[model samples]
Target: MGALMPAPQSKLIVRACVGAAKEAARGHTSRASKEGCANFEGLYQDSGGGVVEVSQTKCNIRARNAAQRWSMDANADGIQVFMWDVVGTLRDGFISWSNQATWVILQDAAEAEKKGLPFLPRRFHAVCGPGNVCILREEREQSCRTRAFASRSE
Candidate 1:
């Protein structure tokens, strides 16, 4: 007798994942679905040969604005990546800070000053002039730090 025919694979399964992260915060997390397959297909004309293969993948993502700080957990495999876009002006913007270094420095300085102790001075460049010149001054300061960070990566 002929051998029994094998079961046909289902062609309606789909895979998807969704994630959300706060603006200028650290350690982003994702939510996963409990019922979903990794592949999908629909009725359509064959491309060339008799058999056909189809697949569809989706990812739902949401993110907020970054005011003073931003952070996300890196994947172990280094495959997934994230990016964002800014909108509107600073007057309508919201802010969030995640890095602890800023707080640590402020706390240490406050304690030292209370005891009449000498503390190392921390300096930051700022725009003092008015009008369009202010924007140019801000850009110059940003470029300095950007160049330094990019060079280290190389």
Candidate 2:
């Protein structure tokens, strides 16, 4: 495991502790995601991933990470560590109070294809940003309809 600094403009998928947060926000008890995950939601909204119900355009990684810390300190780890993709150029390639202190950087794009998809267990490698480390210990693949997604011009 390596570590660097989190960058601006990142996409992160985290399991939101929606039970309490939801109850507080909407005044109703909420259930976990259908996959038996605690709201495996994305902070950044993008149609790139087919998980519609779980995907959003808005970002809230900072809020979510802070909440997860609060949960761990207050209780056991309420949120599960799910895999994520965080890609962006950092402000100074170092952690700072003004920016996120942690990063979950996946292998560079060129490196990923060379060793097969980075999502594969063996091929997976990441660097934790400054504050702490985040790794994908295990992942449950969620199947989706690929045809619905427009091919990336890149």
Candidate 3:
């Protein structure tokens, strides 16, 4: 409906925050997704597809025949404390973040409309992992990689 709604095949950006998935659902867009969508009904069509699978569980609700086939080794807490990038497509009204079919992850919600942060509408906040901020990016013509540690000053 607007640029904020993002076009299909676009990337999503989630900025993580601490809150209940239920509250996050109530606090998020009216679209219906999975998990945290406990209280919100009839407000928005069940347009969003796929459930967000956890890192350890190796689950994806959108895949018709997806199997749990990822290694659960190498747990890192550092990834939990900061934000990361997720490249996904917005089909219908759903989002599926994937690593070239490696593993698909889902978010309980997107865009904290009430967060009141300058970056709120520009990012996605999901129930994935430690609730860290997630940013879906636009597919660039050129691939690039940049890494930064928040402990260090910009």
Candidate 4:
């Protein structure tokens, strides 16, 4: 028999992951905001050749005119990643931080997608602490886990 096609839900997860990465790259290469923070929202092509919308915002209390803090919206057809007061610039550390966080979620999501396993939309929060370490927690769960990303010299 021919290989089975990935389920619709699985495809969406894979697409969202790819789209999230694209969005992160776009945010990184665009510019170093004069405000020292920016809000990025755009469409990205997914792994399966589909369009996915992604949005992100980063802010720091120490930054100039830092109006917004940080927020992310959950979407069935897209992905969102948010950071608050991350310690470095887009080229220096933000890209790596965002990618690492994306990969953490994507690792599980991709496995389920590859296996064609069913999945429900889930929300995750990644909070970065000292030493560039982050804790990712699912919105529904009480427990938290730690993941570390390399920190670039500022």
Q: Over the stretch 21-140, how does candidate 3's per-residue lDDT look in tens digits?
A: 222212222342343221111111111222223222111222221122321222112112111343333232232233321111222323322443221112222221123222332132
Each prediction's number of clashing residue pairs: 2, 3, 10, 0
Q: Hey, what RMSD does candidate 4 come out at?
A: 16.5
lDDT of 4 by residue, 27-77 (tens): 333333454443323332222222223343433211111122322342111
Write the residue-wise lDDT of candidate 2 on 44-114 in tens digits.
11111111112211222221232123211111011232223322221111111222333222222223345
TM-score of 4: 0.26
> Higher-lDDT candidate among 3 and 4?
4
**Clashing residue pairs, backbone N/CA/C < 3 A, model 4:** none
Ranking by TM-score: 4, 2, 3, 1
Error of 1 at 89 (Å): 18
In terms of TM-score, which candidate is strongest? 4
* Candidate 1, backbone clash total: 2
